[model samples]
Target: MSKTPAFNRRAFLGSAAALGATSVVMPSYAQQIDPYTGQPIVGATAGATPDAGAVQYDTHANQRHNISSFRAQDWRPYFDNLSNGAILCDLTSRAVHYWSEDETVYRLYPSSIPVSEDLTRTGRTEIIKKVEGPSWAPTPDMKKRNPEWPDFVGPGPDNPLGTHALWLSWQYYRIHGTHDTRKIGRKSSNGCIGLYNEHIKELFELSTVGTQVLLI
Candidate 1:
Protein backbone atom coordinates (compact mmCIF):
# COMPACT_ATOMS: atom_id res chain seq x y z
CA MET A 1 0.00 0.00 0.00
CA SER A 2 1.25 3.51 -0.77
CA LYS A 3 1.19 5.61 2.37
CA THR A 4 -0.03 9.16 2.01
CA PRO A 5 2.90 11.57 1.89
CA ALA A 6 3.80 13.18 5.18
CA PHE A 7 2.45 16.70 5.63
CA ASN A 8 5.21 19.16 6.45
CA ARG A 9 3.73 22.49 7.43
CA ARG A 10 6.86 24.62 7.21
CA ALA A 11 8.26 23.00 4.10
CA PHE A 12 4.93 23.36 2.33
CA LEU A 13 4.74 27.06 3.16
CA GLY A 14 8.10 27.70 1.56
CA SER A 15 7.40 25.60 -1.50
CA ALA A 16 7.56 27.29 -4.91
CA ALA A 17 3.95 26.43 -5.69
CA ALA A 18 2.75 28.87 -3.02
CA LEU A 19 3.90 31.94 -4.96
CA GLY A 20 0.86 33.69 -6.42
CA ALA A 21 -2.15 35.03 -4.53
CA THR A 22 -5.53 33.47 -5.29
CA SER A 23 -8.58 35.54 -6.38
CA VAL A 24 -11.28 33.72 -4.38
CA VAL A 25 -13.08 36.13 -2.05
CA MET A 26 -12.65 35.18 1.59
CA PRO A 27 -13.39 37.72 4.30
CA SER A 28 -10.61 40.35 4.15
CA TYR A 29 -9.94 39.70 7.81
CA ALA A 30 -9.58 35.97 7.14
CA GLN A 31 -6.59 36.35 4.81
CA GLN A 32 -3.42 34.73 6.11
CA ILE A 33 -0.15 33.01 5.19
CA ASP A 34 -0.87 29.67 3.60
CA PRO A 35 0.97 26.99 5.55
CA TYR A 36 1.12 24.88 2.40
CA THR A 37 2.26 27.72 0.16
CA GLY A 38 4.00 30.56 2.03
CA GLN A 39 2.16 33.19 -0.01
CA PRO A 40 -0.58 35.24 1.60
CA ILE A 41 -4.05 33.96 0.68
CA VAL A 42 -6.41 36.76 -0.25
CA GLY A 43 -10.08 36.30 -1.07
CA ALA A 44 -12.31 38.25 -3.43
CA THR A 45 -14.90 40.66 -2.08
CA ALA A 46 -18.00 38.92 -0.74
CA GLY A 47 -20.64 38.43 -3.43
CA ALA A 48 -18.19 38.98 -6.27
CA THR A 49 -18.60 36.56 -9.15
CA PRO A 50 -16.14 33.68 -9.40
CA ASP A 51 -13.46 34.11 -12.07
CA ALA A 52 -15.10 34.40 -15.49
CA GLY A 53 -12.82 31.72 -16.85
CA ALA A 54 -13.66 29.13 -14.19
CA VAL A 55 -14.60 25.92 -15.96
CA GLN A 56 -18.03 24.34 -15.64
CA TYR A 57 -17.61 20.65 -15.01
CA ASP A 58 -21.10 19.58 -16.01
CA THR A 59 -21.80 20.45 -19.62
CA HIS A 60 -25.57 20.07 -19.23
CA ALA A 61 -25.83 21.81 -15.86
CA ASN A 62 -28.74 24.06 -15.12
CA GLN A 63 -28.45 27.84 -15.07
CA ARG A 64 -26.10 29.08 -12.39
CA HIS A 65 -27.65 30.57 -9.30
CA ASN A 66 -26.23 33.46 -7.28
CA ILE A 67 -25.63 32.61 -3.63
CA SER A 68 -26.34 36.16 -2.54
CA SER A 69 -29.99 35.73 -3.40
CA PHE A 70 -30.34 32.92 -0.88
CA ARG A 71 -32.08 34.00 2.33
CA ALA A 72 -29.59 34.34 5.18
CA GLN A 73 -32.31 33.82 7.77
CA ASP A 74 -32.53 30.17 6.83
CA TRP A 75 -29.14 29.44 8.30
CA ARG A 76 -28.12 32.41 10.46
CA PRO A 77 -29.34 30.73 13.62
CA TYR A 78 -26.64 28.12 13.28
CA PHE A 79 -23.78 30.59 13.44
CA ASP A 80 -22.34 31.17 16.87
CA ASN A 81 -21.26 34.77 17.35
CA LEU A 82 -18.91 33.82 20.19
CA SER A 83 -17.28 30.84 18.56
CA ASN A 84 -13.53 31.06 18.04
CA GLY A 85 -13.26 28.07 15.73
CA ALA A 86 -16.51 27.08 14.16
CA ILE A 87 -17.42 26.44 10.54
CA LEU A 88 -20.95 26.98 9.32
CA CYS A 89 -21.93 25.56 5.96
CA ASP A 90 -25.12 26.87 4.37
CA LEU A 91 -26.11 24.09 2.07
CA THR A 92 -28.83 26.25 0.54
CA SER A 93 -26.39 28.88 -0.61
CA ARG A 94 -23.55 26.44 -1.14
CA ALA A 95 -21.29 28.59 1.07
CA VAL A 96 -19.10 27.96 4.08
CA HIS A 97 -18.60 30.55 6.79
CA TYR A 98 -15.46 30.03 8.82
CA TRP A 99 -15.08 31.84 12.13
CA SER A 100 -11.54 31.99 13.40
CA GLU A 101 -10.21 32.58 16.87
CA ASP A 102 -9.53 36.21 16.02
CA GLU A 103 -13.22 36.60 15.25
CA THR A 104 -12.50 37.00 11.58
CA VAL A 105 -15.25 35.76 9.25
CA TYR A 106 -14.35 34.23 5.90
CA ARG A 107 -16.74 33.06 3.24
CA LEU A 108 -15.92 30.06 1.06
CA TYR A 109 -17.83 28.31 -1.69
CA PRO A 110 -18.71 24.65 -1.08
CA SER A 111 -20.61 22.24 -3.27
CA SER A 112 -23.81 21.07 -1.56
CA ILE A 113 -26.24 18.23 -2.23
CA PRO A 114 -29.65 17.49 -0.78
CA VAL A 115 -28.73 14.34 0.97
CA SER A 116 -31.83 13.59 3.07
CA GLU A 117 -35.35 14.83 3.51
CA ASP A 118 -34.68 15.74 7.12
CA LEU A 119 -31.45 17.52 8.01
CA THR A 120 -30.39 16.44 11.47
CA ARG A 121 -27.21 14.77 12.73
CA THR A 122 -25.37 17.19 10.44
CA GLY A 123 -25.93 20.16 12.69
CA ARG A 124 -22.88 19.74 14.90
CA THR A 125 -19.63 17.93 14.25
CA GLU A 126 -15.91 18.42 14.71
CA ILE A 127 -12.89 17.81 12.53
CA ILE A 128 -11.24 14.55 13.54
CA LYS A 129 -8.25 14.59 11.22
CA LYS A 130 -6.54 16.59 8.52
CA VAL A 131 -5.07 14.91 5.45
CA GLU A 132 -2.80 16.53 2.90
CA GLY A 133 -3.19 15.41 -0.69
CA PRO A 134 -5.68 12.79 0.43
CA SER A 135 -6.36 9.61 -1.49
CA TRP A 136 -9.86 8.86 -2.78
CA ALA A 137 -12.23 6.00 -1.97
CA PRO A 138 -15.80 5.85 -3.15
CA THR A 139 -18.28 4.87 -0.45
CA PRO A 140 -20.84 2.16 -1.17
CA ASP A 141 -23.51 4.84 -1.27
CA MET A 142 -21.43 6.83 -3.71
CA LYS A 143 -21.04 3.82 -5.95
CA LYS A 144 -24.78 3.31 -5.82
CA ARG A 145 -25.24 6.84 -7.08
CA ASN A 146 -22.86 6.20 -9.92
CA PRO A 147 -21.99 2.60 -10.49
CA GLU A 148 -19.16 3.66 -12.71
CA TRP A 149 -17.18 5.09 -9.75
CA PRO A 150 -13.92 3.32 -9.18
CA ASP A 151 -13.07 1.70 -5.88
CA PHE A 152 -10.00 3.84 -5.29
CA VAL A 153 -7.86 6.63 -6.71
CA GLY A 154 -4.41 7.80 -5.64
CA PRO A 155 -3.67 11.28 -4.38
CA GLY A 156 -2.89 13.86 -7.06
CA PRO A 157 -4.37 16.86 -8.87
CA ASP A 158 -7.00 14.61 -10.45
CA ASN A 159 -8.11 13.03 -7.17
CA PRO A 160 -11.58 13.95 -5.97
CA LEU A 161 -10.23 15.22 -2.67
CA GLY A 162 -7.85 17.59 -4.42
CA THR A 163 -5.01 18.66 -2.12
CA HIS A 164 -6.38 18.45 1.42
CA ALA A 165 -9.28 17.23 3.51
CA LEU A 166 -10.58 17.97 7.00
CA TRP A 167 -12.28 14.84 8.17
CA LEU A 168 -15.46 15.49 10.10
CA SER A 169 -16.68 13.58 13.13
CA TRP A 170 -19.81 12.76 11.21
CA GLN A 171 -19.16 9.45 9.52
CA TYR A 172 -18.17 9.77 5.86
CA TYR A 173 -18.56 13.54 5.80
CA ARG A 174 -15.65 15.88 5.16
CA ILE A 175 -14.71 19.42 4.35
CA HIS A 176 -12.24 18.94 1.56
CA GLY A 177 -10.72 20.25 -1.65
CA THR A 178 -12.01 19.41 -5.11
CA HIS A 179 -10.38 18.71 -8.48
CA ASP A 180 -13.05 20.65 -10.35
CA THR A 181 -13.21 24.18 -8.98
CA ARG A 182 -16.29 24.81 -11.06
CA LYS A 183 -18.19 22.66 -8.57
CA ILE A 184 -17.71 25.28 -5.92
CA GLY A 185 -20.88 27.30 -5.21
CA ARG A 186 -22.93 24.63 -6.92
CA LYS A 187 -25.23 21.81 -5.86
CA SER A 188 -22.94 18.86 -6.42
CA SER A 189 -21.13 16.16 -4.46
CA ASN A 190 -22.60 13.31 -2.42
CA GLY A 191 -22.92 15.04 0.98
CA CYS A 192 -19.48 16.41 1.78
CA ILE A 193 -18.57 20.06 1.47
CA GLY A 194 -16.19 20.83 -1.38
CA LEU A 195 -13.65 23.65 -1.66
CA TYR A 196 -11.33 24.84 -4.36
CA ASN A 197 -7.79 23.48 -4.02
CA GLU A 198 -6.43 26.88 -3.00
CA HIS A 199 -9.33 27.51 -0.66
CA ILE A 200 -8.92 24.14 1.07
CA LYS A 201 -5.18 24.68 1.35
CA GLU A 202 -5.77 27.93 3.19
CA LEU A 203 -8.45 26.30 5.30
CA PHE A 204 -6.19 23.37 6.14
CA GLU A 205 -3.60 25.81 7.42
CA LEU A 206 -6.08 27.65 9.61
CA SER A 207 -8.13 24.75 10.93
CA THR A 208 -7.18 22.62 13.91
CA VAL A 209 -8.03 19.01 14.77
CA GLY A 210 -11.14 19.78 16.81
CA THR A 211 -12.69 22.73 15.00
CA GLN A 212 -16.50 22.71 15.22
CA VAL A 213 -18.57 22.53 12.07
CA LEU A 214 -22.27 23.28 11.59
CA LEU A 215 -24.00 22.28 8.36
CA ILE A 216 -27.44 23.68 7.59
Candidate 2:
Protein backbone atom coordinates (compact mmCIF):
# COMPACT_ATOMS: atom_id res chain seq x y z
CA MET A 1 0.00 0.00 0.00
CA SER A 2 1.27 3.51 -0.75
CA LYS A 3 2.19 5.52 2.35
CA THR A 4 -0.38 8.27 3.11
CA PRO A 5 1.09 11.82 2.81
CA ALA A 6 0.66 13.85 6.02
CA PHE A 7 -1.53 16.93 5.79
CA ASN A 8 1.01 19.78 5.92
CA ARG A 9 -1.00 22.35 7.92
CA ARG A 10 1.86 24.91 8.03
CA ALA A 11 2.43 24.64 4.28
CA PHE A 12 -1.30 25.00 3.63
CA LEU A 13 -1.44 28.15 5.78
CA GLY A 14 1.61 29.62 4.04
CA SER A 15 0.06 29.05 0.61
CA ALA A 16 -3.18 30.74 1.73
CA ALA A 17 -1.25 33.76 2.98
CA ALA A 18 0.56 34.10 -0.35
CA LEU A 19 -2.71 33.97 -2.22
CA GLY A 20 -4.22 36.67 0.01
CA ALA A 21 -1.23 38.91 -0.55
CA THR A 22 -1.56 38.58 -4.29
CA SER A 23 -5.27 39.46 -4.13
CA VAL A 24 -4.60 42.59 -2.12
CA VAL A 25 -1.90 43.93 -4.45
CA MET A 26 -4.22 46.01 -6.59
CA PRO A 27 -3.07 49.15 -8.48
CA SER A 28 -2.82 52.33 -6.46
CA TYR A 29 -5.46 54.07 -8.52
CA ALA A 30 -7.92 51.25 -7.90
CA GLN A 31 -7.75 51.93 -4.17
CA GLN A 32 -8.58 55.64 -4.37
CA ILE A 33 -11.54 56.98 -2.37
CA ASP A 34 -13.59 60.13 -2.59
CA PRO A 35 -12.27 62.32 0.19
CA TYR A 36 -15.60 64.15 0.46
CA THR A 37 -18.06 61.21 0.36
CA GLY A 38 -15.85 58.65 2.07
CA GLN A 39 -16.94 56.15 -0.58
CA PRO A 40 -14.86 54.11 -2.95
CA ILE A 41 -14.65 55.88 -6.29
CA VAL A 42 -15.31 53.49 -9.14
CA GLY A 43 -14.84 53.71 -12.89
CA ALA A 44 -12.94 56.96 -12.66
CA THR A 45 -10.70 57.79 -15.56
CA ALA A 46 -7.06 58.85 -15.59
CA GLY A 47 -8.16 62.35 -16.60
CA ALA A 48 -9.92 62.87 -13.27
CA THR A 49 -6.74 64.47 -11.96
CA PRO A 50 -3.58 65.86 -13.50
CA ASP A 51 -0.74 63.46 -14.16
CA ALA A 52 1.95 63.12 -11.54
CA GLY A 53 3.91 66.43 -11.21
CA ALA A 54 1.16 68.28 -13.08
CA VAL A 55 -0.22 69.94 -9.95
CA GLN A 56 1.42 73.36 -9.57
CA TYR A 57 2.10 74.48 -6.03
CA ASP A 58 3.40 77.92 -6.96
CA THR A 59 0.05 79.08 -8.35
CA HIS A 60 -2.04 77.84 -5.42
CA ALA A 61 0.39 78.03 -2.52
CA ASN A 62 -2.05 79.12 0.18
CA GLN A 63 -5.23 77.41 -0.98
CA ARG A 64 -6.59 74.21 0.47
CA HIS A 65 -7.20 71.80 -2.39
CA ASN A 66 -9.51 68.79 -2.37
CA ILE A 67 -9.44 65.87 -4.77
CA SER A 68 -12.50 65.55 -7.01
CA SER A 69 -14.78 62.53 -6.66
CA PHE A 70 -15.29 60.44 -9.76
CA ARG A 71 -18.25 58.44 -8.46
CA ALA A 72 -21.08 58.19 -10.99
CA GLN A 73 -24.40 59.85 -10.20
CA ASP A 74 -28.06 59.33 -11.07
CA TRP A 75 -29.89 62.19 -12.80
CA ARG A 76 -33.42 61.50 -11.51
CA PRO A 77 -32.96 63.27 -8.17
CA TYR A 78 -31.80 66.45 -9.89
CA PHE A 79 -33.78 66.72 -13.13
CA ASP A 80 -37.41 66.22 -14.07
CA ASN A 81 -36.47 65.11 -17.56
CA LEU A 82 -33.33 64.80 -19.62
CA SER A 83 -34.45 67.69 -21.77
CA ASN A 84 -31.56 68.49 -24.09
CA GLY A 85 -29.40 66.60 -21.60
CA ALA A 86 -28.37 67.72 -18.13
CA ILE A 87 -25.21 68.78 -16.33
CA LEU A 88 -24.78 68.77 -12.60
CA CYS A 89 -21.91 70.51 -10.83
CA ASP A 90 -21.47 69.30 -7.29
CA LEU A 91 -19.45 71.88 -5.37
CA THR A 92 -18.83 69.67 -2.37
CA SER A 93 -17.50 66.89 -4.54
CA ARG A 94 -15.55 69.13 -6.90
CA ALA A 95 -16.90 67.12 -9.79
CA VAL A 96 -19.21 67.54 -12.76
CA HIS A 97 -21.77 64.98 -13.93
CA TYR A 98 -23.33 64.93 -17.38
CA TRP A 99 -26.17 62.90 -18.87
CA SER A 100 -27.31 62.90 -22.48
CA GLU A 101 -30.95 63.53 -23.36
CA ASP A 102 -31.66 60.04 -24.68
CA GLU A 103 -29.65 58.52 -21.80
CA THR A 104 -27.17 57.18 -24.26
CA VAL A 105 -24.17 58.91 -22.74
CA TYR A 106 -22.94 59.78 -19.28
CA ARG A 107 -19.67 61.35 -18.13
CA LEU A 108 -18.08 62.46 -14.91
CA TYR A 109 -15.11 64.85 -14.80
CA PRO A 110 -13.03 66.48 -12.12
CA SER A 111 -13.68 70.22 -11.79
CA SER A 112 -12.33 73.41 -10.33
CA ILE A 113 -14.85 75.20 -8.16
CA PRO A 114 -15.12 78.63 -6.63
CA VAL A 115 -12.41 79.44 -4.16
CA SER A 116 -14.89 80.93 -1.72
CA GLU A 117 -18.61 80.82 -0.95
CA ASP A 118 -19.08 84.46 -1.98
CA LEU A 119 -18.06 83.64 -5.54
CA THR A 120 -20.19 80.51 -5.76
CA ARG A 121 -23.76 80.36 -7.06
CA THR A 122 -26.19 77.47 -6.79
CA GLY A 123 -29.31 77.09 -8.91
CA ARG A 124 -30.69 75.90 -12.19
CA THR A 125 -29.29 77.35 -15.39
CA GLU A 126 -28.97 76.49 -19.05
CA ILE A 127 -26.21 76.81 -21.58
CA ILE A 128 -27.10 79.79 -23.76
CA LYS A 129 -23.98 79.82 -25.88
CA LYS A 130 -21.09 77.60 -26.84
CA VAL A 131 -17.81 79.06 -27.98
CA GLU A 132 -14.64 77.41 -29.12
CA GLY A 133 -11.42 79.28 -28.42
CA PRO A 134 -13.37 81.52 -26.09
CA SER A 135 -12.01 84.90 -25.09
CA TRP A 136 -11.62 85.95 -21.49
CA ALA A 137 -12.61 89.19 -19.82
CA PRO A 138 -12.35 89.88 -16.14
CA THR A 139 -15.73 90.57 -14.59
CA PRO A 140 -16.12 94.05 -13.16
CA ASP A 141 -15.99 92.50 -9.70
CA MET A 142 -12.95 90.50 -10.67
CA LYS A 143 -11.15 93.62 -11.81
CA LYS A 144 -12.03 95.34 -8.55
CA ARG A 145 -10.28 92.63 -6.62
CA ASN A 146 -7.32 92.08 -8.91
CA PRO A 147 -6.42 95.53 -10.14
CA GLU A 148 -3.31 94.36 -11.97
CA TRP A 149 -5.04 91.61 -13.95
CA PRO A 150 -5.34 92.14 -17.66
CA ASP A 151 -8.73 93.51 -18.74
CA PHE A 152 -9.01 90.98 -21.57
CA VAL A 153 -7.27 87.88 -22.82
CA GLY A 154 -7.98 86.54 -26.27
CA PRO A 155 -8.24 82.80 -26.92
CA GLY A 156 -4.79 81.36 -26.53
CA PRO A 157 -2.49 79.70 -24.04
CA ASP A 158 -2.89 82.70 -21.72
CA ASN A 159 -6.68 82.63 -21.88
CA PRO A 160 -8.21 81.48 -18.64
CA LEU A 161 -11.23 80.05 -20.49
CA GLY A 162 -9.01 77.44 -22.15
CA THR A 163 -10.00 75.92 -25.49
CA HIS A 164 -13.77 75.58 -25.19
CA ALA A 165 -16.42 77.34 -23.14
CA LEU A 166 -20.10 76.67 -22.50
CA TRP A 167 -21.69 79.91 -21.51
CA LEU A 168 -24.50 79.64 -18.96
CA SER A 169 -27.61 81.74 -18.48
CA TRP A 170 -26.21 83.36 -15.38
CA GLN A 171 -23.89 86.28 -16.01
CA TYR A 172 -20.18 85.56 -15.69
CA TYR A 173 -20.79 81.88 -15.06
CA ARG A 174 -19.52 79.16 -17.36
CA ILE A 175 -18.53 75.52 -17.55
CA HIS A 176 -15.28 75.80 -19.40
CA GLY A 177 -11.84 74.34 -19.89
CA THR A 178 -8.69 75.47 -18.18
CA HIS A 179 -5.15 75.43 -19.48
CA ASP A 180 -3.94 75.24 -15.93
CA THR A 181 -4.48 71.53 -15.44
CA ARG A 182 -3.57 71.84 -11.76
CA LYS A 183 -6.84 73.66 -11.16
CA ILE A 184 -8.93 70.58 -11.85
CA GLY A 185 -9.84 68.66 -8.68
CA ARG A 186 -9.26 71.76 -6.59
CA LYS A 187 -11.20 74.79 -5.35
CA SER A 188 -9.27 77.32 -7.41
CA SER A 189 -11.59 79.03 -9.87
CA ASN A 190 -13.13 82.41 -9.19
CA GLY A 191 -16.63 81.14 -10.06
CA CYS A 192 -16.69 79.15 -13.26
CA ILE A 193 -16.48 75.35 -13.25
CA GLY A 194 -13.18 74.37 -14.86
CA LEU A 195 -12.27 71.09 -16.52
CA TYR A 196 -9.16 69.66 -18.04
CA ASN A 197 -8.73 70.71 -21.67
CA GLU A 198 -9.21 67.18 -22.95
CA HIS A 199 -12.26 66.58 -20.76
CA ILE A 200 -13.99 69.88 -21.65
CA LYS A 201 -13.39 69.18 -25.31
CA GLU A 202 -15.28 65.93 -24.96
CA LEU A 203 -17.98 67.55 -22.84
CA PHE A 204 -18.26 70.47 -25.26
CA GLU A 205 -19.06 68.05 -28.03
CA LEU A 206 -21.47 66.04 -25.87
CA SER A 207 -23.35 69.17 -24.76
CA THR A 208 -25.25 71.78 -26.73
CA VAL A 209 -26.38 75.36 -26.27
CA GLY A 210 -29.63 74.34 -24.60
CA THR A 211 -28.16 71.85 -22.15
CA GLN A 212 -29.59 72.20 -18.65
CA VAL A 213 -27.16 72.89 -15.81
CA LEU A 214 -27.53 72.72 -12.05
CA LEU A 215 -24.97 73.73 -9.43
CA ILE A 216 -25.16 72.51 -5.89
Q: Among these predicted structures, which one has the highest lDDT? A: 2
The true-structure Cα RMSD of candidate 1 reads 14.0
The CA lDDT at 94 in model 1 is 60
Which numbered prediction scores highest in TM-score against the true structure? 2
Per-residue lDDT of candidate 2, residues 1-216 (tens digit): 999755342443244212311111122442254322345544422122221112111243343433323467899999999999999999887778899999999887767787667778999999999999988777777666656556667877656777999999998888988765555656666678988777789899999989999999
Per-prediction TM-score to the true structure, in the order listed: 0.63, 0.70
lDDT of each: 0.56, 0.68
Tens-digit lDDT string for candidate 1 (76-104)? 46655534477777765665666676665
lDDT of 2: 0.68
Q: Give the TM-score of candidate 1.
A: 0.63
Give the Cα error of residue 177 in candidate 1, in Å.
0.9
